[model samples]
Target: MTWLITGGAGYIGAHVARAMTGAGERVVALDDLSTGVPERLPDEIPLITGSTMDADLVKQVFAEHGVTGVVHLAARKQVAESVAQPTRYYRENVGGLATLLEGACEAGIERFVFSSSAAVYGNPDVDLITEDTPCAPVNPYGETKLAGEWLVRAAGQAHGMATVCLRYFNVAGAAAPLLSDTGVFNIVPMVFDRLTRNEAPRIFGDDYPTPDGTCVRDYIHVADLAEAHLAAARRLTRGGAAGDLTVNIGRGEGVSVRELITVIGEVTGDGRAPVVEERRSGDAPRAVASAARAAEVLGWRARRGVREMVESAWQGWQLHHGK
Candidate 1:
């Protein structure tokens, strides 16, 4: 079956596209190239250079490529920027998704995999976040994702389609240096940037209610996350589940900021101390995934550890920086 992977040239999308194609699944990629790198995609995969907001273009791609399934990963994901411009986030993430869903339903696509986020459970009070955890997004970005999930599920139910929403935790590492995440939105790359400049990495809040007084998070390798998508897509094709499947893609392990900084120092051979600063607002003290539902539903679990993530990420950093 031919699958259309939106934002397939970006870091996570590129990995998903490669994994799907490697599994012998027919694939076509659609990316706007806003922050995506075309070079990251395999040479043989056909790429459509456009946005999902363009209903005409999306429909054209679906019809032209004979797309039977869709993996939607295209969205404005920056939390801070989403807060600053909520309307744009709604328009791009939510509105664009509605348009795409309309096109997908019209084109007779029955399977869908949406890219959700852990941000939907903003600052959860629970020890570990599960698929059943209450969703209370603190930022506009997360709100848009939750709203998109509703739209996807409603559309699927109405159209008799199978859908899966994968809520991602902290994504890191890379399948290859070229596929490494180029954005510095997460701690891994933020610390990598500071180390590259021989500067002390800034640790955002050290007074959190966690070990070593720093925030803790669940970090998952990008490759493992991509494989999770494959599992979800495969399940959709089987048609056994009664409703849309929602699952978390994580390792079910928590790593503190201080601990991660030390790991980075060890991995990069740069043991520069980090500079602690006041806590950023909306920062969760601890956010870890249960990952039980994912295994039960998709038979998928993360295989790579934090050390491997750091090692692979450091290699990508060196390659990208020419260090």
Candidate 2:
């Protein structure tokens, strides 16, 4: 089946596009090159350059590509930035998606895979969050993502579409580029970018309720997260499930900030260490996912572990920084 990937030139989208093409599937990458690089896309995969907010452009994409399924990874994903500019987040994240959905429905696309986030759970009280957990997003970014999820649900209900919203938790690493040109504000690669030479990676909320008094997160490899999208597409294609599906795509383990820094030191061969600072408000102490639902539904599990996450990220950082 042919697939249309929004933001296909970005990190996770690029990885998914490559994965699709490597499996001998027909694919079209629709990206505006905002944070995305054209060089990231494979030549064989046709790249459609335009904004998702343009209804005519998105419709044109569907007409030219014969798209059967969509992997929608395009959105304003920065939590801090969203907090600063809520209007931009609403317009870009929610508005652009509305246009995309209208175009998708008109073009008769039935399957969709949304890039949701564990931030929707907004610091769940439970040790491990599940699909049934209430969405109480703390930041504007998370609110927009949750709104996007609801929009997907509405589309599914009105039409006969089957959708899977993969909620990611502290996504990092690279089968490709972990350090994709995420805006300067992101957590992982931004830290690595600053520290490629001797700069220290900054840690917010050093005294969290975790093993080492630093925040703990479930960091999944970008490739594995991309694979989860693929598996969901197949499951939906088989007419297996109905209604809006939300699943956490995490490794189901907590990697502390200090632990990650140690791994980074090993990866970069720079034992410079991370600079700890006072807590950032709205920061979750520990966010681990009960990814059991993903395993059951998508038959997907994160095969690459913590070490791979650190090393592959270093690989991308080294290449980006000419180290």
Candidate 3:
């Protein structure tokens, strides 16, 4: 009963891989090294160097390892980048899933997990977004993710592929150093990186409708989010029915951008604040998860506070960069 985690050597994928392996599950990771690093995974787990978009490679990995389940995490994730390059997002995020689904459905891999994004909600009229929210995505990145989920759903109907889609917001922190550098990727670490160098973190907007006049979002610790994935995997392993199980993996509360800078200051013991800038395109006024369904259905809720999330991230940053 082996499981395959695509993009397992990357940020959140590495954390999920560590948690699953710690629970004594036999796990294998497949990554193309485009954004993944080998050092992020534990020594015992096997990593295949290939893209999930490759039909032959996907089938070969499934057959070679006798995989029972899959956690698909590999995708082009930047919302701004997607806006710039819509075609690449479609090909990799949509086309790749299409190819992988063909192989998984054929190989009888029933249990499947997908790493979706809150971008699917795309600045909903409601302050908080629930699973039932109308998914009117704003960017190509979100569109592709929604499309990927649809493909997986089709597979669930055609074959008995029990699917779970975790709609993610800000997935950050590093429990283990999978990459050599922390600040090279992600918005959270990028801000932290600026602070470490005594530079002002960029606050894209500060005149929003929220309390702090900044964009508000629910940022979940990657560790807590990873556990939710494992629980979904367990449900699938229990011969769960073939249907779509969509859950938002975030705490119910929202944090403003300015508040985040203040929190980072508190966590790092620095009084430095962020530098205000013009609003970044595609940013919403407020984005938070209504995680009731996740807690009720998957028995999962994010327990870590904003402080812990920042502290763990600080610890990871210090560990990686010695600051």
TM-score between model 2 and native? 0.95
Best lDDT goes to which candidate? Answer: 1
lDDT winner between candidates 1 and 2: 1
Q: How close is candidate 1 to the true structure, as a TM-score?
A: 0.99
Question: What would the TM-scores of all predictions be?
Answer: 0.99, 0.95, 0.95
The runs of at least 3 residues in candidate 1 whose Cα sits more than 4 Å from the true structure, single-residue gaps closed, are none
Q: Across residues 1-323, which tens digit of lDDT does each residue of candidate 2 receive?
A: 88999999988889888877876778899998888888888779899888889999899889887888899999988888898999999999899989999989988889988888887889887788888988899999999999999999899779888888989987777786643544445565666776755588878877776779998888888888878877887788777654578889999998888888888777777768688888888878888999899999889998889888777876777677655
Could you arrange the candidates by TM-score from highest to lowest? Answer: 1, 2, 3
- Runs in model 2 with CA error above 4 Å? 177-184
- Superposed Cα deviation of residue 25, candidate 2 (Å): 2.2
Worst 10 contiguous positions by lDDT, candidate 3: 174-183
lDDT of candidate 1 over 123-234, digit per residue (tens) = 8898999999999999999999999999999999999989999999999999999999888888999999998787999988888888799999999999999999999999
Q: In model 1, which range of ten residues has the least summed lDDT?
A: 314-323
Q: Let me know the TM-score candidate 3 reaches against the reference structure.
A: 0.95
Minimum summed lDDT over a 10-residue window in model 2 is located at: 177-186
Clashes of each: 0, 0, 1
Q: RMSD for each model, in Å, please? A: 0.8, 1.7, 1.7
